[model samples]
Target chain A: MALLTAVELTIWVLEGQIPPPIPVPGVKLGLASVVTLAAMAVLGRREAGCILLLRVILGCLFAGSFSAIIFSLAGGVLSWAVMASLIGLFPEKLLWVVSVFGAIGHNAGQLLAAVAVTKTPGLFWYGPALLTSAIVTGAFTGLGAMYLVRALRKYRERRGF
Target chain B: MKRKTVFWLALFAVLAALGAGTYLLRGVAGRRAVVSVDGEPMRTVDLTAAAVPYEFTVETDYGRNTVRVSQGRIAVVDADCPNRDCVKQGTISDGAIPIVCLPHHLVIQIED
Candidate 1:
């Protein structure tokens, strides 16, 4: 879990350096979520939750912004919950579908947080754009997680760990 | 393709289509730009009437943002926030997407 958390934290911090490929406000690749899903698949829901919580908290400390923590926590928790509930239903081949839903949940949570903090219902106008981005990015990350899970399983079996 | 694969693909295709439709249809050029801070209206500028481009600063308990307005567009020219996402957003001339600074709790939207 600690190793997975470190990897996730690194991806989150590094991903922050790249300007969003899509110029839309609040849109991100959310690559760190690949680790979360993989951990859930390999380890367990509880372990995945622990990794996500640690990554969010430690990520905010590294970013050094109080406001960011709120958004991160909102998105991270919502995404984890959605993926956790759906993880059991989806076979490894269908992990990407669960990931897409989790991605939507993550963005929805962040949008809600933004609307609540700014008290601007107008922010909802960005919802469609966010939803579109989430689906695209989620599919990619889900595929990545699926491959990672397979590779990890092979490695463990080979090493007899 | 497998039945399950085809099902998920069709579902996502429908969703993406719906999202794209709403997104493309949401933007209509408007002359008025409303600036709000912490959900309260702070300023409203009629972009069509502005003969010259001008800038103003919005300072709140959170931070500061310098908003620039021209004939029919608005943007955050500067900000003291860590991310500067608002400034990076460039400008908006339609109701499509508002310039949002999450760090400073600022939003600038163009409306008819």
Candidate 2:
């Protein structure tokens, strides 16, 4: 759990340093979700949630932004819930689909937070763009997590854990 | 294909289509630009009526952004915010997307 949390934090911070590929606000690759997804597949939903919660809290502290915590928590929790509910229903081969759903949930949650924070209904104008970016980024991170999960399974088997 | 795969694929196609539909349909041709800060109306300008291009600055606790306006369009040309995502967004002639400076809690939406 500790190691996974660290990995997630590192990726989250590293990704933050990179400018978004496009000029859209709130659109990100969310590469840290790769670790969360792998944990969900390998370590179970509860463990994954723990890692996600820790990573989000500590990440916000390290980043030194109080407002960021609300957005991160909102996005992270919704994404985790979506993935947890769908993981067992979908075969391992379809983890990308699960990831895509989680991404949509994440974006929706953040949109709600943005709306509430700004008290602006007009911000909903960005919804379509956010959803489109979520699908693209989610597919990329989902494939990454799938490979990570497979590698970890082999490693665990070799170590007889 | 398996039922699950087929179902997901169909769902993805529908969602993609919906997103595209929303994108193409959300643009408003109105020449008015409404600028708001933290939900409060900051400024409103009719882009079509502006005889000369002008710029204005919005200062807030979050940050500052300079918005530029001209005939038929609006944009954030400069901002002190770190990301500068708003500046890079260039301009919006329609309501399809607002010029959002998240750090500044600022939004410039063009509407009729």
For each candidate, give the interface RMSD after superposing the true interface residues on Cα.
1.3, 2.4
Worst 10 residues of 2 chain A by lDDT: A18-27
Find the candidate with the highest TM-score and give its number: 1
lDDT score for residue B50 of model 2 = 68
For candidate 1, write residues B11-56 as lDDT tens digits.
9888878887888898889989989988899999999987899999
Candidate 2, residues B1-112: lDDT per residue as tens digits? 3888788778877777788678778766667989998889899988998679999888888878888888898889998755576787787888777776666778788887
Docking quality category of candidate 1 according to DockQ thresholds: medium
The estimated TM-scores of all candidates read: 0.95, 0.85
When superposed on Cα atoms, how far off is each prediction in RMSD? Answer: 1.6, 2.7
Tens-digit per-residue lDDT, A32-129, candidate 1: 99999999999899999999999999988887877888998999999999999999997788999999999999999999999998999989988987
CAPRI quality level assigned to candidate 2 from its DockQ score: acceptable
Off by over 4 Å in 2: A22-25, B28-30, B49-53, B60-63, B70-73, B77-90
* Cα lDDT tens digits for candidate 2, A1-161: 78889989999999888878865555788899999999999999999999999998999888776667787899999999999999999889899898998998899888888788777898887788778777878888899999999998998899886
Q: DockQ for all models, in order?
A: 0.71, 0.43
In model 1, what is the error at residue A39, expressed in angstroms?
0.7
User: Where does candidate 1 chain B have its weakest 10-residue lDDT segment?
Assistant: B80-89
